[model samples]
Target: MLAGLLSAGVPFPKAIELADPKDLPDKFRDFIVLAFELGAPLVPTLSQLEVQMRHEERTSQEIDQAQAVPQATRTLLIWLPVVSFVLAQIMGLGTFSGILHPVGALAALLAGALLFAGYKISGRMLNSFLAPKPDPTLSLMVLRICLSAGEPLEKIRKRLEGYPDGGASQLVEISKRTGARLSFLIDSELEQLNQKLLSSRIEEARKLSVRLLIPLSLTTLPAFLLLTLPPIIIGFTQ
Candidate 1:
């Protein structure tokens, strides 16, 4: 509807001013208000946002590909006990009967708990690393474009409030207090900022890959022994 209004030659600010605020996202409203206030072209700014989102998507895909092997390895490790149990039964080792002794059952119970905790912690850590953070530079670009176009401070604040944790809101607030141009923070350093953010994320993913190994090993190694050793020990004793 907003697009249709813009296509009808209605001013960007006026189009938003006439529409219900409840219908629009706070950040989106900032774009329209900024364009209307400055008579700036919203298309190019929106296009930039699209490009940045695409870059983020590509980065996430790369991380997933890089992490796939470790994830598959964990899955197999989790199923190792079941495979061992089935194999032992086929061999008539009857190791499970031995494992049912009071002391043996207690040991098995303890091992199962440890395995559960390890996998849960590793999965949580992996997800935390995989989760995308809001693009810090994306917000800065929005704040700069709006402020440079002389968008209203109240309007900017209202829109930026949607993502309070982002750099855009904080930068705009700082600029307002300092009476500095928002563009001053981004105009020259924008590319550098983008590069820095990308590199930092890649580095973080790399470190997380290493951290994941510790938990996976802790879980899988003990599980390997618990499942494979008991039956062998029983067969030999008999």
Candidate 2:
């Protein structure tokens, strides 16, 4: 939509003004507006940004798909014992009757607490997984835009939200030694940054499979046994 508007010679800020806020992300709109203010080449910069955003979106979707089965299993692990206890009581199996004893009541409370803990911990794990990964290329991206716009490093460091002083200095040093354009060097770094982010995401997914197992064994399994065993023991004794 932005590319079409720009191609048709709509004024950059005017094009942005015309867009619905819901249709455009605030950060993206701000980036476009700032890039225009800095006199960066809007078309190519936006094209590159679009490609990166699409790739990140696809990666996120893939991670969510990978998580589906584990999430379902977690739900089942959480609910299966509770459902069994309910059914056992309904079927006149004396499940709640067994829990009417002082000892049984205490056991039920402990099991309930464990089950709740497992549920809360599992949710926290999922929240951490969904949290945004730190972008290694943010400073480089800002530098690229600044260099393209002929903005000074001091100006960028002061004005740009995430432009890092260290990264800017390193890029300048490399440019001086290699006689390379800072823009060109930053582009190469951006490519490598994408590859690094991909690898990091894969590692995170792998670790999540392991992290999820912690609650299953430590809390959920114990709760399941605490709930399940009493009924079985009672039936055998009867």
Candidate 3:
């Protein structure tokens, strides 16, 4: 809508006002408007930004989809033993009588504790995946877009808050030393940022595959044994 409106010759601020607030962050919208006001080209810049945002959204959704099966499996792992015990009782396996015995009661308590610990630990691990953290590269991206405004370096730096002093500063320095265009250098940095972001996502997914095993081995397996074996042993003795 932003690009379409820009192509239709609507003013930048007005176009932003018309666009959905949910589609863009307030900081980004303000920076884009500032860039345009500072003489940056509108349609091309916004079009590229729109595409990047869409890709990020899609990537986030893909990560969530990737997590779905694992999440469901985790729930099942945490509940399967309890469900089995109930089923054994329902089937007249004498599990209730077993559970009434001292050893069976002890096993049940231990199983409950293991299940609780596994649930909490696994839940925390999974939540870490979805935790919201400020993207470090976001500051650089904002700085890059704002740089298009063609303002004096110091003046632009002052206006933009949270501008990273590392990559953005180096790109600006390199542009000055080599007499290269600052905007072009920033675009290259943005490309590198994209690659880094992709790599991080891949690494996170890899870690998730391994991290999931911690709960299975540490708690769920023991809980399963306790919940299943005692009932079977007691039923046999009875």
Candidate 3 per-residue lDDT, tens place, 125-221, comes to 8888778745655656666666665557787567545644437777777888999987777667766776676667757866775787788668888
Worst 10 residues of 1 by lDDT: 45-54
Better of 1 and 3 by lDDT: 3
Superposed model 2: Cα runs more than 4 Å off: 8-22, 86-94, 157-169, 235-238
Instruction: Give the per-residue lDDT digits (tens) of candidate 2, residues 25-59.
Output: 55566666677888998777777666666666777
Query: Over 4 Å off in model 1, which ranges?
Result: 1-39, 88-92, 131-134, 152-190, 235-238
Model 1 clash count equals 0
lDDT of 2: 0.72
Ranking by TM-score: 3, 2, 1
Task: Give the true-structure RMSD of model 1.
Answer: 6.4
Tell me the whole-model lDDT of each prediction, alpha carbons only: 0.64, 0.72, 0.74
Candidate 3, superposed: residue stretches over 4 Å from native:
10-18, 33-41, 90-92, 159-161, 164-166
lDDT of 3 at 165: 45
Predicted candidate 1 versus true structure: per-residue lDDT over 120-184, tens digit per residue: 98789878776857655555666656665667878766765655244666556677799877666
Candidate ranking under lDDT, highest first, comes to 3, 2, 1
Give the best candidate by lDDT.
3
